[model samples]
Target: MGNGDNCNPNWKDASFSYYKYVPSLAAAGIFTGFFFLAFAGHSFRMIKARAWFLIEVLGFAGRAVSANQEPGCWTQPPYLVQTLFILLAPALFAASVYMTLGRIIEVVDGEKYAIIKRRWLTKIFVCGDIVCFLLLGGGGGMLASAKTNKSAFDLGNNIIIGGLVLQLLWFGLFVVITLLFHRRMMLSPTARSYQPDIKWRSYLHALYVASALIIVRNIFRLIEYCQGSNGYLMTTEVFVYCLDALPMFLVVAWFLWKYPGEISGLLRRKELYDGSMHEI
Candidate 1:
């Protein structure tokens, strides 16, 4: 551990230096506000879809508070709170994405075209997400509390990297399943797929955009963690905002612009469709 004079716990006593540069209050505040708008603007019909926005709101709100503290002060609670929340928020975002695809399949009555059975689609991806979430959340907590213990810190970092790898694999498979379903639907279109009001294509496009952004951000994080605390990514502050925060913000914006509630509405209207669909 490094030495410090007056701080409660010497800054050097922390596992890692908290921030290379002071986090920007303005950026954190803007992100928090937008996420709050997303959470509040969603309709009652969109309750399920709106869950992740609340996580983002809390995550960025913690970040906003962390931004006001002295740089490199790892002793504060907000530092750990913001770090863990921000680290884990994307898993929730990906959960909504998984459910959205299942809803989209239902909306188009394209269960037959889906690579995975519609019943299993959300279940499979969400189970994987839950595992990833636990690893990430657990690993983050362990890392945060592992102050001055190099062995504990390395173990936690490895666990986080494992979680990230699992997430990437699951997400990549999800995209493949989505693309295959899209292609099959195009080749043998269902009657519901052609309905003018449903706009399943638009929603699929939005999912593609959101998935791409999340994947890119995850890759950036994977690299950041792999590089370790003293590495270039950790020493630089801009990458966090540029790669992680900005991508997530755009994801929320894209979904807000192309809301997924239509899928839920259509599914509600044709409740029988989900149960009775024939599999090929």
Candidate 2:
């Protein structure tokens, strides 16, 4: 009976062991993302289009490890890196979403389905994404590294909120355009001609779900950062897991499961015959 306790580790010790292994687990996740990136590049040859998604996945993996290692290590360089990776990573996912949507528009023929010219979709949304990334990255770095009083931290948090708000605005516009385009197509004479095949339609639905998931996640993040470090959202791990981590994981998993490479391959094939379908 006395040796029973020694037969197995206590709960606390088991937890510590799990915690200690988290960084290695996170590294494995990052490696998985890199492997997927290479897979997409090798299989589809559309590496340029898939780059943002890979970045986002790797970023999320990095953020997860950082969070586990330093639950609340503010004022530390690791904190800054963690915040930057998590904060900026989603913006990259959004960029990938935008690129995918734009390319879809091109695939369907811009004249009937898209409002903006196909050529302009990537240019506009990606440029906006770049701006958001800079703002969030800069702001998160400052906030995490701030050793000063509350005001300095608040300043950094505010800047992050600003960037997030800007992203929401940009995404809102994109959604509006997408809806309007869909509506326009539904009402047009060429509606029947524009309907995608079953596989393509499935891809479109996947994108829609992915976009909605990301937008919801971003909203949570915007609120979390706006609350500052001492805020309820920041102090609570549950909220972070449910709101931030869950949504992103769902979105990324959905897309990865769908594998955009298949869609891109179709687009490439179509582009050979259709003058309107631009090269991916």
Candidate 3:
């Protein structure tokens, strides 16, 4: 129920954090985009690919904990729904990871691998994603608990931090592997033609925007965790929502929207592996 002597003037605010509302709103926005894809992108094979991320919309959730005991309990509904979302988020995230890898393989490897090997890689990636997701989900669910007792709250905070660390590790590995594969393909003469298929430069802009949103959101979350000793996350719910949540969701939606054309073309002709910038 106190400000807890924030170290910096910037941390002076004692208002409740926007933990609950922001995330819930972002989830809704993501779901709306998913619904659009399900209906509009239905005919395209990439629809299945997008399905992986669409399902992820349900994963956005958080709790209304008074970090280090700030003020009143959450004015919203019970924390149960947020719990479910956090627990389920890892699974959805894993699905997206698998989808991303699968799409990349289709673009880079093309007909190089036999059916068995291709299928094997897909399964292996998916399995790895699943395992990682489960680890994240279990820990993430604990994060949404908002334990009131000081000891319990601190424990929950630690769980969240640990989960974030694990997520960064796993995601970093995937990003590295994917980028290397993309680079190798683009450089190879055979795969050069596929460059046009990638349309990466076109997609890169959207990716940057979406990434900025997600990265900022995650960084903000990390800041909350760093305030370990008498932390105060949801300071001024409105500020948190405006600054971190809505922007992230909107960027994500736009990113997804950019894919329908490229994905549809790739699925129709399987030409993602057959084009390049010949003159450049």
Candidate 4:
């Protein structure tokens, strides 16, 4: 293809160009399947209410991929709507991660094994998540609505960065908590005894992978937005697919493969928590 061909909006033979977008489309399709699995699992009461929320958010994220594709082709209104949903969806997933981790910590013996109180796990992290979501959504909406207003776009991106930073900080703290809990579990027989079953540990490991993937994606987003809309990262497809889309696809896919509903059921049946355990 010539330089002019690169700038062409339409072409008779563009089959090769379509291959570049397969990753995004594949991610969308995979998550669509994951959504159905989540629904089926939840409908049969195999998964808990918390897991249902995770599945619903994955559906939104999967839809965002479709919305995000060919942004240049979308009209102003459609583009704005897409931007809002795409930015908002992942933040919600990060929030759901907090909820997932909270539930896992409860199973792990929150007060005894974890560094922090179990009661505050969801409260603090999820509330922080809400604040981050509002900032990102509000800022994204402002930028999308601003059209050609450069200053407003910059302000909006800055707001998004602020939200991303907060999320990073929260994830960092949670990582520390996870490490401490793991260490305690290894050292204390009581904490290890509270461990549900092998499958439950695998479920927790899946969550750890999910959390790490989301955190990495958030960091990339933070850097991308910090560079502004005109930056290379914003204009590139590879970065978006590798840094953002791939991580999310893996997170949901991993969870679906591990089948959290079954694992949680096993944990419940194992009776890891006596009646005296504090409710999260």
Q: Candidate 3's residue-wise lDDT over 43-89, tens digit each?
A: 35345544434332333322322232233333223244444453344
Separate clash counts for every candidate? 0, 0, 7, 0
Work out the TM-score per prediction.
0.88, 0.73, 0.58, 0.73
Top candidate, metric lDDT: 1
Greater lDDT among 3 and 4 belongs to 4
Model 2, span 14-70: residue lDDT tens: 311111112334543654465456446444544544334344445445445544542
Candidate 2, residue 224: the lDDT equals 79
Full-model lDDT for every candidate = 0.82, 0.63, 0.47, 0.63
State candidate 1's TM-score: 0.88
Better of 1 and 2 by TM-score: 1
On TM-score, the leading prediction is 1
Candidate 4 collision pairs: none
Which pairs, if any, clash in model 3?
16-234, 17-234, 17-235, 193-274, 193-275, 193-276, 194-275
Worst 10-residue lDDT window, candidate 2: 12-21
lDDT of 3: 0.47
